[model samples]
Target: MTDRASIIAVLSALAIAAGGAALGTAGQVPQPAGDAPIIIAQATGAQATGPSAANTFNRLMKRPGSEPNIQPSKDGIHDPANPGTALLQWPSEAFAGFPRTNDGNRVDWVKTLAAGLIRPWTELEDPEAEPFLMDLTIVRQVKGSMPNVVYPHLEHTQWLDCTNCHDEIFVPEKGANQISMAGILLGQKCGICHGRVAFPISDCRRCHSQPKTAEELRQLSEKSSWAKQ
Candidate 1:
């Protein structure tokens, strides 16, 4: 009883899904079409010798500091006719003289904040509103040999309010949210900002900073118990 139109639509959907699966299986994503192809720069600033595609998730995940050849046409923004879009400044000029990093736009955001080069407003409406900075550190123990992650509130609070993350991207309560690397890569949880506006998850050591050895954890636990008594 299916009409010809319905059959055609279903086949088209299946074809699209199949194409996506093939791309995922091959671990390759289509690069934006442009005259200049984006390339990942070597540590020595030399061009990587190969036909390897730039802006691949695996490549970015493995290495940081890939200088992309950004262009209006290939910038991923769909809007072209908007007048304000043309006024937007390029990344190189905008981020000039800022502290440098090995990963994510090659700008050290934390150090930049410390150096007072740029003072981001805590709120958009009220420019005078001050940031609510906190010095609390949360150490999350990871499974297996990976080092534990240390989430510093002070650095983040300086740029954002607590409400920015609470009850939306992340649940305020600990152990309530389930986070995974896959989810993060897919632009979920910390990935919301980490990959887009904030620093991309390039180096694992950047987040996995705390060392949670059994002896160290035991000693710390004992000290905490004694202090509580």
Candidate 2:
């Protein structure tokens, strides 16, 4: 395989091994440091440096409406010569009226799903098949002062199957895996979908929804069982 493809395969394997360990098992994973700017620290021990690091992080936070849709002819991807391409609908028009976000095309997918505007089929061949939606939520405490992460299984499971994450991207057991911001930016763990197909981590509030309570902070510092987990 090519170098790029090989790298992807390895990351995919690691994600499967490490990610699944945080679901429901009694073990707990350590949290990474947080920051106002897009934190790019890696669990792999690589450090981000250089003066441009700040600018680079800011630039990576993509804003919606950066690329406007024009006639297919003028657009870069399509062949203007092809009449069929012109007939295709622009993404702006296609996604019109959908919920919006602060970044990345500005589409609020979770709200869109909750609104019942879209009903995606689970299986192409079996139209009768339905998605198995779970209502569980997993909370991961952050390492520093940032808000804790609230992972709602209902939101994700509504669209994906248990297998989509369980054995591959994340392990099903709790505290078995260690997740880091750096691993995610590299497309490991949650990065497999986030920042790529799903919402980008630039929207810090999206995942870091729960704020830390004073008691929680004390427990974390004291190295409580969950903290050591």
Evaluate model 1: give its TM-score: 0.58
lDDT tens digits, residue span 1-229, model 1: 1244457667976876897688763333344454444444422332558544343334333222223424454366636677777777777777789988776777888898899888778778998888888898988777645678888989888888788898887787778888887888899998898877788887677888987898867766676756578
lDDT score, candidate 1:
0.71
User: In candidate 2, what are the lDDT values of residues 58-106, reduced to their tens digit?
Assistant: 2344222124434456555688888798788787776788888866656
Candidate 1: where is the Cα deviation over 4 Å? Answer: 1-66, 69-87, 214-229
lDDT of model 1 at residue 58?
Answer: 41
Question: What's the C-alpha lDDT at position 4 in model 2?
Answer: 49
Clashes found in each candidate (C-alpha, N, C closer than 3 A) = 0, 9
Task: Tell me the lDDT of model 2 at 94.
Answer: 64
